[model samples]
Target: MFRNRQEAGRRLAAALASFRKERPVILALPRGGVPVASEVADSLGAPLDLVLVRKIGVPGQPEFAMGAVAEGAPLVTLRNEPVVHALGIADSDFEAVRDRELIEIERRRRAYLGDRPRVDVAGRVAILVDDGIATGMTMRAAGRATALQRPSRVVVAAPVASSEIAADLRREFDKVVCLEECDDLFAIGVHYADFSQVGDEDVRRILSHHATVAG
Candidate 1:
């Protein structure tokens, strides 16, 4: 297995080596996806950007994501009714958590992207890259939001993902590419050796590095 995000990204880049000539755009789902996406972008010589989305977590158990939020056009919210009911999460609680997450999403967009107008996606192939997928809520949100931009194809690429969620996501996107799929995928970190928290500052630093390289 890949040791860390960089190693995983390198392996993933090799798997996707054929895409280089097509010059597809890579949109990373920050703040964790930035590092991995950077490596993919460098390997493929493609421009990198961010697809902003927020996790709509259940109240109290903040890590349990029931859905997600994204800016631009109609916001995408994927509801797992069975999970919500089983978890006893009320509609009010979901709405409250969604509001909070949306606020943070806006702050992230402002802080990380600032004045860098979002690149147009119409007729372009938008590859949504994430470090890994557990609940798949955030990636679903990214896919839905990218749908609004009317991209020719939306590809979901991750180093690892829960098999069930990957199958679910396959129905929504043109292609779902995952390096590893496990049935017992309880957490995204379980598959990584150095699964550290990626901070906003780290994202900013990587973005800056990308900018310098582009310039």
Candidate 2:
């Protein structure tokens, strides 16, 4: 098991050392991802940014993701049609949840980012970082959304993830970098000894630190 997010980040940075020359931008999924991405950005001497995406959970079963929405200039949404159809989720119902998530996304963007101009991903390799992946819905949505920015390539990097999910992500991202992939992965926290909850303040602090370092 990884010691913590910092250790995981350092290991992940080592694995991605070859990309230092490419100068890829590190786009982290906020809250948990910020801490991990902070170390990566510093190690690679790359600009740090966010790929805000939220999973649209199934009604009554919030753990079951039906789709995900990514915040951007126009926003990007990806739905699992099979899951939605099988569950008989109506358009109105789906819209309601998506709308709610959008609001939360705006709130987070404001809280964590404020008015900072987003890093340009155009023609540059965009590396998406997170603590781990389970269903892979959030990362998938974030990838598709980042694609809209016309990055030269999209790479998803994480410390731990399910082997099956990592394979699935390969189709969406140009490259997937996962330090530990377990077929029988249970929870993301299981791999981290200190998987404490990451708060907005923590995210803000990390981002601020990266910004200062980059400058």
Instruction: Give the TM-scores of the predictions, in the order they appear.
Output: 0.94, 0.95
Candidate 2's C-alpha lDDT? 0.91
Candidate 1 ranges with C-alpha deviation above 4 Å? 212-215
Q: What is the C-alpha RMSD of each candidate to the true structure, in Å?
A: 1.7, 1.3
In terms of lDDT, the best-performing candidate is 2
Give the poorly placed runs of model 2, Cα more than 4 Å off.
Answer: 213-215
lDDT by residue (1-215, candidate 1, tens digit) is 56888888888778777778776788899988888898988898877889888888777777877778877677777776777989888888888888888888899988998987566777877888999998888899898899899888998999999999999999989998889998988877878889889899998888877774441
Candidate 2 TM-score over all chains jointly = 0.95
Model 1 error, position 14 (Å):
1.3
Model 2 per-residue lDDT tens digits across residues 65-115: 899999976788878899999999999999899999999999998998999
Minimum summed lDDT over a 10-residue window in model 2 is located at: 206-215
Q: Which candidate number maximizes TM-score?
A: 2
